[model samples]
Target: MQFMKFRKIFSVALAGALLLTSTSLFGEGNVADAAVISSIPNTTRTLKSYDNSFLSVTGYASLSGGVKDRSSYVGTSYYRTVKTSREFLQALLDAKSGSVKVIEIAANLNLGWKELNLSSTEIQKYNFVAKYEDPTNGYTNPTLQANGVSKINVSDTNGLTIFSTSGSTIKHAELKLQSSANDIVIRNLNFDEMWQWDDVGNHKEVGWTFIKVNGANNVWIDHCKFAIGADGMVDIENGSSGLTFSWCKFGLEANTNPASDSAIYKSITYMEQKYTSNQLASTSLYYKMRKAGATPNQIMAYSAYHSKCHLVGSGDKDYVNYVDSNGKDYKDGNQRLRITLAYNQYSNVGQRVPMIRQGVGHMINCYIDDTTHMNLENSVSSFKANSTSLARGMNARNGASIAADTCVYNGVTEPIVGTELQGQDTSNMDPQWANLFKNAYNRNLIVNSQVTNANGTYTGSSWDNNGVNLFTKGFVWYNKSTLNKWAWSSSIVGAANMSKTKPPTTPFTFQYNYTEKLPYSYNAVPLNDVVQTVKQYSGASKVTLSAKDWLKTVYSTSSTPTTGSSVNVGSYYRIKNVNSGKYLSAPTDASGTKLVQTADKTQATSLWRIVAGDTGYVNLVAQVGSASKVIDIPGASTDNGVQLQIWGGTAGADWQQFKLKDNGDGTFGILTMISGGTQGLDVNAKSTAEGASVIQYNYAASANQKWVFEFVK
Candidate 1:
């Protein structure tokens, strides 16, 4: 009996819940526990439920405000009221409003401004100081006497500031909040329309951030649609504690005026300028964008106050950066320059914006999908991380240090888990933009979820690419086998030695593909049919066998064997010494059956010849388990009548070879030895019914010989 070699990587899922001993370094204090609130009316009214869940501000019911009574109180629970953005702003600034019991913001909060004017050019034209009717009001109105606009401040006097602070537009909203000392909960409200452009075909430049919570603890933004907007659909402020944005849709709007040209150029310039000023703390911000609307363009800016501004970019070319020499080097004015912008796109064309900046950015267990053109910057320009940075997207850009412009794209691919850059679409083009801004932001997940491609090729890089373009992680999928590079983590080797062109063996998260254990099984065939069948479906063609030896040619790494072959453990072999009429032997089975004895030899003349026949009978009756690759001949075999032959000749000519050696004990050992060994299978007897005469023949050259042993006592 001869043994064939087989190799198997440890399955990640097979490893049961790994007990990660709680450590001070990787503590669980940061892990938030969330309570899903229902969409029904007023479920989050009680302050107790909001306690410890972060700060939740719900505005589901109508809020009544009388002229004399400057305070706006939440109306009855049953009343489904519409709260416009103006009203929300009023309520937030209402003097009589007590300590916010979690910014309980809710629906119908519209932003209705028709031809409004302003005085302050610095803040925004629509900037109006909320003044309490009474002199003792807690909030004080900012001075509005810019030039000659002293009396032109009230809504009636100025008609209302419809479009104020430029850059991104925000409109239409609702919210329900429950708050406690350390947490907040916001449920069942829409964050729709950032800026309402005039034309139906234009894309808006404004981005609306529903709730900008600053200096809070344990925040969760989930099940929300941040659809259609020019600016960030949702922006979490700096110094916020434990925030999560999950199950949300973020994309561009099909119908809206393109974002103002000046605003975009200025935003980028502003970010670069700010970085130039702060060399110690600020780094480049990564902005990722997907192609959408008539023109797929994106813009981003990194804030100045916050530190750790390490930036990178993601998404398509449309979402990347455009370095221009327009605005004054205000950032570098009279100061030594410290930073630069090393920006790049996936394909050299496309627009990208910094939807997310780094303030405490973290995307854990979150998904980024279906973005035609995206710019994923690594700096803290737009999207900030409040928790973990485990995201999914088309690509991503990362930087090394502050003032660093060196950014690279973390293109989304498969089996090679990336640094969260991923997509759900396999098509070459971007997914269609939606009528609403929120839908566009979330289009990726929706499109990816609809991908039923049998091959699981549901991403842009998956098609028209080979293994080099496709990346496969043992567990976490990110690398593109086509590029043959690992964009994020180092492959097995630490990040320092990680290959920019190879997939990492280590996973980015616990849920990587390696977490699952695969069950082993084989295709059954008669002893007379083993050899022929294996020939048809074995080795590099149908097995994980190294094609280098089988094909007798030097092939690319991709052409090498993978884990797509089946196992055939029952194939048997008959080993006989050429000069000495003996066979290999080991401990006998319960039935006292063993290989014919053979004296070890040291020359090629002592070769063995083999023939195909049914050996299952010998295996069953003899009590010797019908295992694969368990024998070793004293000498090698020659094309001639090699006397010493341990052949597993099945139906066809000689094929299977027993290379895998069995453990001295009864158990079969691992085949496919990495160091040095042949990968193939040996034949087996049909059963005692066949008088142990059924033995097959073959060479060791396929995954079929790699048998997954299941010991039966």
Candidate 2:
């Protein structure tokens, strides 16, 4: 599925922290001198070859100085095909600096998951308060594990393009590029099975990244699908620059959260039972805060879903300090972390769509939809400050400069952050939000909620500066830098209902005293076409397979519909397991009944009708079950081995909607749409007994996952 290349690379004129506690989330405060680079370039260097910039490498990756990389160009080499995990790793090892080596992933590669390991016996220490790692070494040394995490760690390896052939899936792993590595291209491959639960309430587990740019430079990542990782989906850190992410789909469904049996829940239960109140309080803030006001259930509820998404810089004081092999200092006078995110789609994300500390970004035509948040739907337009999604959409911190206007935002709690003033009145009636909005948010199309609008509609409220500065400037910064960037958990608990026409109070400022803009040019499509464009082209073409809907078939004649049925919806089919030849059955016609695999085909419970659900998915409604009863995971869990069940009153939840993936072999895999489109139903132990359990597991393509949906008359 080689994409014919459509337009992307929009204006994200670019651009954290470590705090661990039950209530004290990882946050940034009004402290510390802001990070500073030797120089801030007025404009980015322009690219010479700009033909068919659509889906092509553009933005900072196509240029230099505050971008990801220079380009993926360096001459061409015959592509070598790789099918297995080992072969995939070997091909990357074979890469050199002169000629670009193209590798076509031909198979669904499953790299297993891995926890952190040093590779060496040296004990690594972490300074939690200072937020620094590898303090003794002063050098960044990372071990590249081959399984479940295909790390890109080739030192000095410049030219490489890894593309998918419309069928391959690289999951349970990540493709990380270290600082010593540079000049790489990753396109059209789906990256999933990467997100996992951390030590509950204490988001201190800082290692999950689908594509971690740990100080890597000049990298072009396009057409790739990324799921939320524990730490971040794509983290650019350690002074890496020249990066571009175009035509990509990031985040997950609005309600995707950890199962009741997941690590977060288990951890909360363990901590609650293991430590007493005063004893636990004496040890950590996580417990102390929970003791203060938050209940264990409250902590688990708050800590369930992933909050952060794409991160440009790792932390506030995290500066670039690399000396290239050519003796060129990469730190003394380094460019800001420059990134471009155009024609990308962000759905149900919490925050940090390329949130940077000291970088410049240009985000062109993009679609950001976070309105589906459970909290938002219940709030009816009022935003709760303690909710993890309090801060949604793009943010700027630590003197970071960002420009994002040519985009559509829907139901974002705080559409833009790090650019606004914190602690305004609860009424959200204050005219002075941030000094940067009159220029950025003023141009964005924003709405509070498509489903939950209690206050009037609003958009330009969250756009503000992200850092606290010592140097003074305007109403706040003019000769008086920021007091501090707002925390992720905002304190303002109300609708940010300021209209676009509303003017800030007297002596207000809109322009920033210190900012960086890009020189690269890419025309944006009409705003009307943004949602359709990205949905049609983003992600690996073969995985979600949504690209085909826009690329060729059913052109513009039909728009993507908001799917679902209150009870019964579409066609009926009898689902039979490919392995055991057993039928997926539900008996007693009751809710909360665990679905089982049975040998009986005449049972009415075996029949299920498919109803449209959550766009590009379908709900399997049990024929004789309770009213509106559909197939669902007990806790809407993402973990393996969670038994499938029939539940009533789900209201076409995304968790109940399965992506019926055609196996190309007269069979299908009923995949969970929220598990990044990988985890699916499996016949437990491949059992052939009278009644065997059907549970969710990572997609293995084995007969257990393969099922034949027999059409019923």
Per-residue lDDT tens digits for candidate 2, residues 1-713, read: 00011001111101011111111111233332222321113433221211123544667777653222212221234456778765665566566534336666877776552332223331122101011122121111112122224343445566556766343567655566766676777777777654433423334444656777777777777767776556667877777777888878886554324455344455455556645544454445445545455566555554434567777766433423444557565541112576878678877666776676545666766777665554533542211333344435666553455555346665554454543332221132223433322222111111111111222232221221222221111112222233322211111111122222343243222334334244565556544455555565566551232221111111111122211111112335678888898889987667778888888777678887665455446667777633246788878789899999887634446677787675544577788977977899999888988789999999988998888766553
TM-score of 1: 0.26
lDDT of 1 at 654: 25
For model 1, residues 440-465, the per-residue Cα lDDT tens digits are 11100010011111123222222112
The parts of candidate 1 lying over 4 Å away from their true place are 1-87, 94-97, 102-107, 112-184, 195-217, 237-239, 252-713
Candidate 2 weakest lDDT stretch, 10 residues: 1-10
Candidate achieving the largest TM-score: 2
Query: Considering every candidate listed, which one attains the maximal lDDT?
Result: 2
